[model samples]
Target: MEAAVNDQPRRGDTEGFVLQVRKIGNSVGLILPKELVARANLREGDRLHVAELADGSLQLSARDPHFAKGMESAGKAIRRYRNALAELAK
Candidate 1:
């Protein structure tokens, strides 16, 4: 007989629902649940950025906040000095 499974999200993660990493051809990967994928707004081909925290924990997000902030600053600088940048580009 098979054990019953509950499909619900909780405060704690990977407790009972452990995501086992296995070899997929050459690379090892984990298979996420459909519910989790929908909650994260992730698709099959969507790119994810993984970062290691100071506490030795890993974080996964669609985009890098650090890079996004840097780009935002660069955009502001370009807008403020558009004429100067245009002259330099020539």
Candidate 2:
């Protein structure tokens, strides 16, 4: 899916394309265009964090620095207590 954004649009112009919501099996999803994905540096199976702004607009980002740091700390703890975790799981 190729999309072309008008090159001469003024700043803050709301000239955005509308995407249809499609049913994917039991879940619904929106298909993002390949060009947009490439510009975002996102790939298949990559995680995206979506947040709703105060104006009801949605923001999608590829990386959440805070979440990444929390995950890194959790990973270190898990590695340090691997044996204890395994024993607890038994």
Candidate 3:
């Protein structure tokens, strides 16, 4: 999807198309258009990093330090919890 232009103050990113929030299980989510996703260099199941700026505005991106650390930890956690997780499935 092409970017949407407006008077809203923002940084780096050009305003894009709006996505409708819908229910996914008990959580609400917004579906980004495939074109927009491709433009943003995002793919299905890709994680995003979000932060709130000092000016009370929000930012979203793909780079995340915490996520990197968590990913490393996840490898260990997966092995540690494998038996428990497998048992829970039954």
Candidate 4:
């Protein structure tokens, strides 16, 4: 099935895309168009984070802010304990 772009504004300031959910084996998924994928800077094998907004709308993003923050903190910790970690590994 094809995705239909709705020109009408939905839920205050957002536009809606009518997508068809298809069954893939035991899982159901939506087929995103190439144009949309390219516009979103997404490619094959990239991870996407899905979230449900307060209004129950689904949001998809290539990057997770929380995960990025956690990774940054972990990197700082690793750098701070590099010598200890190396000694422990020996």
What's the C-alpha lDDT at position 69 in model 4? 93
Q: Report the C-alpha lDDT of model 1 over 1-72, residue by residue, as the tens digit.
A: 222355333335644345556566787876677777888899999988898999998777998788999999
TM-score of model number 3 = 0.50
Order by TM-score, highest first:
1, 4, 2, 3
Best by lDDT: 4
Across 16-46, the per-residue lDDT of candidate 3 in tens digits comes to: 6645556667878666666767888998889
Ranking of all candidate structures by their lDDT, best first: 4, 1, 2, 3
lDDT of 3 at 65: 70
- Error (Å) of candidate 4 at residue 60 is 0.5
Task: Judge candidate 2 against the unseen true structure and give its global Cα lDDT, from 0 to 1.
Answer: 0.75
lDDT of 3 at 53: 94
lDDT of 1: 0.75
What alpha-carbon RMSD in Å does predicted model 1 have with respect to the real structure? Answer: 5.6
Q: Which candidate is the best by TM-score?
A: 1
Better of 1 and 3 by lDDT: 1
TM-score of the candidate numbered 2? Answer: 0.54
Candidate lDDT scores, in order, read: 0.75, 0.75, 0.73, 0.76
Query: Please, what are the lDDT tens digits per residue for candidate 4 over residues 1-90?
Result: 433554322232456455567666788877676667788888888888998999998888899979899999999999999999999999
Candidate 1 runs further than 4 Å off:
1-17, 78-90
